[model samples]
Target: MRRALTWVVMVAVGIFAAVGLWSAAVDPAPVSAEETAREVSQSLRCPTCAGESIADSSAMLSDAMRQTVDQQVRQGRSADEIRAWFAERYGDQVLLAPPRSGYGWVLWVAPLALVGAAAVVVLLVGGTSTRRRWWAALLVLAVTSLAGVWLLVPQTTPDPQRLKQEDPPQVNAVAVLRDAVDHAPGNAGLRIAFAGALEEVGQDAEAVEAYAAATRLRPLDSDVRYRHAFALVRSDDPGAAREVLEESLHVRQDHAPSLLLLGALVHGEDPDRASALLQQFVQLAPEHPAVDQVTAFLAGQLDEVPAEALP
Candidate 1:
């Protein structure tokens, strides 16, 4: 039993040591749709926003654009192919995603070169026994070979149309917005759709125009006004955003997202107002994640305030 326990402990320690070393040596590669979208969005302008990208946008159109990207990725198109297709359609403005050819070749080769250089330095300094050195080289070579095979192997072809069909946009918001604008030639609905898509993709300024158009067309629509206010806030025009939100609330009280966003906006500049609004939000939505986060954040701020400001 003693001998067995000793061996078990030794094995555990070895595993822990190996894992620590492996983790220390390997930098994780980014590989999620969100990460890819962020990377791509940074490079491309939002079609609707003056200078926003789809990755940062909150409008419905931006969501559609991202959905399109997700569909292409699913259909076995390389990231490069997908970006290139957009570039062709919208010109260089569409290529929010990184290029992989020519100057972009550095993105592909730099990581490998860095790893190789580090490994060589480690080997030279570590001074492993001959047998260990040979084994390490062989293992590294095997890993490299496997990676090459994976990258070079032909992928299974998929039908692009079918992939898109599988994931239809929630609102067809992108097309409907475009068509409305084209057909009506100053239609507020169409403008709203266009602006919304731009905002969703991170073009705050463009979204504001659409929201403004929508407000002009339907002065009674508090939702449009609320959206406009948020767009202004997102664009760092807080004074205008507050005015819009106030107008929206006057038209229709008890708006949820607007209220929450208002609370968030006021939190830093006017803690008293922020605290009151956030407290209301917390009471209204105790179970919501946003509520929880806001409550905790507000509590922290309260804790930081001077004794004189507590009241």
Candidate 2:
């Protein structure tokens, strides 16, 4: 019994050591959509809120980025692919970790090369007798092989409790927000947040309804109404969007977005009115970047309202 207990303890220690080595080489594998989204978000820097990953940020842009990550994860996008997507859109600074390819690869290779050289020197210097050298070399080879296998091979725990701990129950952020909205049916902020999250994932129709509810709750908020119109346009309800934009302009005519979107919405049906709204938008917001686009629109182009035209 004593010998068996010793053997069991030795095996357990070896298993844990192997796990430590493997974990040092790579991150824990994400086993569910929520985990995958979290892992991806944690690896990317939040553009609006630096120093915090999107996973930890409460910034609006971070929320959108997280939703995008979740959608892509559900679509089976690989982590590298999702990282590349963010890099392409937001530039390389968005990645918390630099790419392992290209010139940066030297950074990764150098440490490993140094460690290998150190191992070689230790083996040569530590071995004095031929018999000792043989044993040392054998031990080194065994250790290196074991490490290589541990790093390369995928591991799954057979214990149910460990598996439960490793992969907690997946939670859907959207579903959670939806439940919050259901519980607080009059909470316009929850409605708007849930709507924005839906819009981030391309659920335009549902976002339109959510934004519409927000608009009704906060009719005086020009920004809320603008979002409602924008969501309406995305859902192919341009007629209703035009009416909402018109209503927003009636309340706040200085609203550049309402003028800009209404101009485009009416360009085909009412050219003269479209030109007037476009011309007014340029005069009211001359320093705005969209002014140049509006100028082109006045000249002959019908500019599509870019997303988030208000702010």
Candidate 3:
């Protein structure tokens, strides 16, 4: 029996060793602290999400902002200067992730506090057996180690999307929208304008949220709804676009633009059904652009007829 127990222990040790090796092989090598900090900050919207910085956005404007960051970094600009550049352009709104001051301190402290509380709880539970307490201590140690590692790790990689959310190195139209959002938190028009700016610059995700907020504030406005749906489509989130289009249709039937988009979407997925919708579209507006092209395309599927029968 002793020999059998010894064999089981050996097997367990071998399994653990293999797992450790596998994990090491699969885990990526640690990045520089600076790169890690950059990635974490990137893609994080400014507090309102409408005031997204280049680091937090994937827009064309954000791309330009990122290029500026790279140029500045290469030119030996200080971290403070780089951050200040964005702060100057978009004001405080361009910061991706909150600044590490004021309310921002809360974000940094919450995780650490949770871990510390857990460790304290484990220590206070003295009624547990010695072996159980040891295991608890080990768990707390692992958590503490991970927290420490997170603190030490630098953000190194720069995300272009985050450039929009991060402070811009310069002032521009997006800055205007940011200012507007700051002054009028409850204004739907201001939100929509910011969303458009985001889309114009290629920050689709932030634009999506901004558009959503605009629509929520003015659900009766088809213009806002259409823009919201269009933004969703631009972001390549067709599922959301379709749903919004349907909602818009429910509110106002025979909306030609919505019909056109839905018809295209439906047709892309199922040609036969789309063809029927195209016919309906023709009946609704014969002189619409691309009408002849669509009709000719549909004609290919029908039985051939002589020119004399043509409309």
Candidate 4:
């Protein structure tokens, strides 16, 4: 028994060494292309994180975003075009810096103006009586504090009615999407958009319903199905999420998002299936931001990772 155990260990070590050698032989991605991808990624916030740039985040969504950036960069897309694509997918908040044209100039210039104004007030009051100088200081402090609060503190809940009344609710706000769905109830795309808007507003249950309706309208669309699965997961319906993801995989076996999500959902209950799916995910998306996360998870769970899944 001891000799057999020793032989098995030897074989495993040999296999791993061979796999390592093969993985090392493969060339890495181009350095310039990676640097360009990083530049664009740094400009975009991770959709699933608070103020975290996608380039600097470890979340799976950020990984996917980075992968998109890398692919667009490799395709020779211009920086503005890449940014525009991200904005369309995730909205303008994805861009760290707001546009400077139009009234947006107010957002950029107001703080500087407030500071400069306060400085001038202080200079003017420098030679005044102590009481008068103190009054001027108080006034300046109040104005600066209010300006800071206005620019820094995000509103907890946006007024949907006010946004709805705006000429262009940027097309994806809850009220506008709700109106869009009302006007075109049968449109699968509209349903998906409304569902996304609902998701953004913490209406996960309603989002699930909308996503379900979208899947009913476009049954073979793997994208819609996977998105529905995501909503179901967010709604705390893991069983249904698994079902929807499996259905999506049935439609398109190589769908990476579906594979990644389903693998995570089933990781504890059906580890073998999860491992297979995760292996496929890594195979399909080797450059994903969460590759390290997935790799670490896999190493922790398994006694020995398969050679193909190693690098």
Clashes of each: 13, 0, 42, 1
Better of 1 and 3 by lDDT: 3
Candidate 4, residues 168-220, lDDT tens digits: the string is 21223565456446545687877887787788889999999999999999999
lDDT of 3 by residue, 218-259 (tens): 998777787888788778888888899889878887666666
- For all predictions, the C-alpha RMSD in Å is 18.6, 12.9, 18.5, 26.2
Tens-digit per-residue lDDT, 27-127, candidate 2: 67777888878878887765554356678778655665676677677778987799887676556666665555676567546655655665566677765
Worst 10 residues of 3 by lDDT: 302-311
lDDT of each: 0.60, 0.70, 0.62, 0.69
For model 2, what is the error of residue 77's alpha carbon versus the real structure, in angstroms, after optimal superposition? Answer: 39
Q: What is the TM-score of each candidate against the true structure?
A: 0.40, 0.46, 0.41, 0.43
- C-alpha displacement of 271 in model 1, angstroms? 1.8
Indicate which candidate wins on lDDT.
Answer: 2
Local distance difference test, candidate 3: 0.62
Residue 69 local lDDT, model 1: 64
Better candidate by lDDT, 1 or 4:
4
Ranking of models by TM-score: 2, 4, 3, 1
lDDT of 1 by residue, 1-311 (tens): 44544554565555556555554456333377656555544554456554456676675556455656655655666556666766665555444333456665575567666657655665776565664465445445544643453344322223433433343223334453554364454556557768877777787887887788889888778778888887887788988988887777677667655666676666678888878776776777667557646766776844432312211
